[model samples]
Each structure stands twice: as structure tokens, then as C-alpha cells.
Target: MRILLTLILLSGLAAARANGYDSLPAPAPAVQSVPAVQKMKITDLQDLIARSDHPLIINFWATFCAPCNKEIPYFQTTVDRYAGSGVELVLVSLDLPDYFPARIAAFAQSHAYTARLVWLNETDADYFCPKVDARWTGGIPCSLFINNKTHYRRFFDRQLTEPQVDLEIKEMLKPAP
Candidate 1:
């Protein structure tokens, strides 16, 4: 009886292996077709901020802002170094709505900015600024760090350096209380 039962179980195991039940599940497909700059609403931003599995670094900038332009390369370097580390970088463009083809897209393509790029569609800085951060004065070159898992958040209203971002990442990685 034992031998008969063992043979039946072994055959079932072999059938399951043949049907791929022994292998790890496949990974989700990569998102390779995002728009260069999707129009993002405040609600969209809130949802992004609430993601708990990974840390997010959001840089607010515009095409015409000189300081914002200068900091792009540094942020790009951060993106490359932190790839696959559960750290997401988003360059939020505050460019005027009409500048997508003539300025925004051209500038992003020219710089080869590979990080996710989004355009905050709201124009009323006074109303939206407080939504982002109470201390924000609607400044370009601002960077916000959020780690929902740890409940850590930070806001920087000026341009950021590589060192500053490194420090911020360390803070974001600290364990939640």
C-alpha cells in the first residue's frame, strides 16, 4: 500500500514539474512606453507619495530655469547609481503647458534624461505649493524625498548636490519607529 501511494504521489509531482509548477513565478513586464512628460494632477502626486515599498525622490524643475537645468546631470547620475535599488527618481517639469514640443520634450531628449519625467499640470502655485509642502514657496529646483515604509519625508527648496542626496537616502532607509 505504501509503495503504491508513493508511486502515485511521485507521478503527480512529475506532472506538476512538467506543467511549470516548480518554477518561480515570472516577473511583471517592464514599463517601457511611458510618455516623456505625462500631465500629473495633485491626486496623482498624492498616490505616488503614498507608495510604501520604495523610496521616491521628486525634483521639481522647469526647462527655462537655469539652476534646475544645471542640476539635471547630477540627478541623472543618482538615477544610474541607484537603479534596481528600489529608489525611484522623478523629474517633475513645471514648464508652461504649451512648451511640450518646442521646449520640454526637446530638452529632455537632448539631455537623454532617462528617469521618469512628469509635468505637474496645475498652474496655481499658491494652491498646489501647500499641497506639496507647507514650507514650499513655489520654487524651482526643489527636491522632495519620501519613504512611506519608514514614514520619512523631506523637502528641499534649493538645488541639491550628489552628497546631499546620498545623505537623504541614508535617512530614508532608516527603520520605521
Candidate 2:
């Protein structure tokens, strides 16, 4: 019986080797989970806006808004299209706190989104909304195009098309006149 068991084990090992499965690689060490989205209060956003030296596109989006979802590709393509221009883009998430990090992070990761991602940590829109735009009525799919040095700034609060994005980027990159 002992010899039979040994033969069976050796056969199994030989089969593994024959199939090019020579001893499996060591199991990967356990890894801790980390949120891909960073938390930032509205004030941090304000600071970022104030400090940007190059043209910036700050796109406000959420997991639940259909329009927001629709226009993501426009912005993502803008990211790739303008990568050589030194212009920057950030996708700031406003997903509800209940879903928070998981749904939003998964959305970004699943889509292979390439822009910098952030989650607004504030709950009070009354305080944060105006900081983004004075006329803002808590809209999704909104955006801010800003250049601190050129003092060029524009804000849009509706779904954007690729042509509109292209025009806006060209306008934002125009030399201050």
C-alpha cells in the first residue's frame, strides 16, 4: 500500500512536470487593500485651482448621473489627446458617502480611467457648490477650465461634446492676450 501511494504521488508530480507546471510559483504574499481615489475637501480643490501653473480641466462627476457617465469618454480622450501639451485634467467624484470609495474606485478602475481621481469629502453642497461656481446649482457633468498665469477661466455645467472639449482646450492653451 505504501509503495502504491508513493507511485501515485510520483506520477502526479511527473504529470505536472510534463504539462510544464514544474512546482507552482510561491503564492503571492497577502496584500492590503488601498483606495484608488483620494479624499479631498472643497478647500483642497480651491487650493489646487489657485496653484495650477498650467491649464487645468477639473471635471465634476458622480457614479449615479447618466450625463456624467456619458461624457467621461470625452474627457478621457481629451486626457490622451492633450498629454503632450502639459495641460492637466482631474476627475473629481461626488458619489454619495454611503457608496463612497468602493463603487467610485471600481468605476474608475473598470473603465481604465487615466486622469487623476479625487473624491469630495464634504457633505454640505451649500458651502462647496459656490466655491466651484457662483451660479452652480449642484449640477453633475460640470467642468472648470482654468489657467492661473493666463487668468483664463471658463465654467460649463452641462454635458460636453468632444468638439466642445477640443475647442475649450485650444482656447485655454491660447497665449494670454
Top candidate by TM-score: 2
- Candidate 2 residue pairs in backbone clash: none
lDDT for each residue of candidate 1 in 83-143, tens digit (9 for 90 to 100):
7668888888876576653456556765667778888877667667778888887666799
lDDT agreement with native, every candidate: 0.72, 0.76
How far residue 105's Cα lies from its native spot in candidate 2, in Å, is 0.7
Candidate 2 residue-wise lDDT, 1-177, digit = tens = 223323433454466457764432333334623337888999999999999988899998875555776888878797678888788889898765754576676666655566788999987777887899887776677999998878999999888998999999999888889
Whole-model lDDT for model 2 versus the true structure? 0.76
Candidate 1 error regions (>4 Å): 1-35
lDDT of 2 at 127: 80
